[model samples]
Target: MNCEQIRELLAGYQDGELDGAQHEMVSGHLEECADCRAELAQLDKVKEVTGKVKYNDLPLEVWEGYWQGIYRRIERGLGWIFASVGAVIMLITGAYYLVKDYFMDPAVALFPKIGVGALIIGGGFLLVSVGRERIFAHNRDRYKEVQR
Candidate 1:
């Protein structure tokens, strides 16, 4: 057998899975080929190290608690989302009324009105800047789909 064929059969040979004829063919090739022998030796080392490794399995109670923790996080996240939306709506409504009242009052100075307008414009610019930054960051983020 050629080097490629012998290499392919090396795994099965190491595991003693080959029949009499195939076994003899791979054995003869290994005797003559130093490179294939080296490769087989490397494969044997890998198998030996991996065979000694052990994995720990979690108990059922730990798994149940893990799922419960996830559920609680989801529930809290939804609650916070609702609370934030409500708070933002209330704040916007209050700001609108305050601005409207200021504009309607005869005693209010022109400079204060102008200042409020400038503040609103500045807030708009800040919001847009933050949005653009978030979009750019999202595009560049390598682990965008990876969960927390």
Candidate 2:
């Protein structure tokens, strides 16, 4: 195997994932290639160090405390959800009357005025979007010319 092939297989070889034939090929290559040998040595050192490192074990009391914290958060989250639902119901009820009193009335009204204002704002936004697109396209063409 070439150096690149050996390097690609080196990680799997170190992890004992290679078959016997593949292992032999890598071993043969490592023997002949100084670079692959050095790489394998480095991988072996990393595996050795990682294998020797110790992990801290959590106690049962710690696990209980973690669950307690999670339960408290869940309770608080549920409370917020209920409060938000209540607020939304209140807003819908309040808005119903306000909209009826202000807009649905056939007398001197604000609905047509608000509708015209919204149309004007929407038109302005459309113009701004088109202008931005044109500006970006022009800048992009200039940048391409500079790159060339």
Winning model by TM-score:
1
lDDT of 2 by residue, 47-143 (tens): 8777655222446666887789689769967986898799779868866775677556778467785985587569769978996997699689758
Clashes of each: 0, 0
Local lDDT at 97 for model 1: 90
Give the TM-score (vs. native) of candidate 2.
0.36
Taken over the whole model, the C-alpha lDDT of each candidate is 0.83, 0.80
Please list the residue runs of candidate 2 whose C-alpha ends up more than 4 Å from where it truly belongs after superposition.
54-148
Error of 1 at 72 (Å): 4.6
Model 1 stretches astray by more than 4 angstroms:
1-56, 59-62, 131-148
Candidate 1: RMSD over Cα atoms? 12.3
Question: Which residue pairs overlap in candidate 2's backbone?
Answer: none
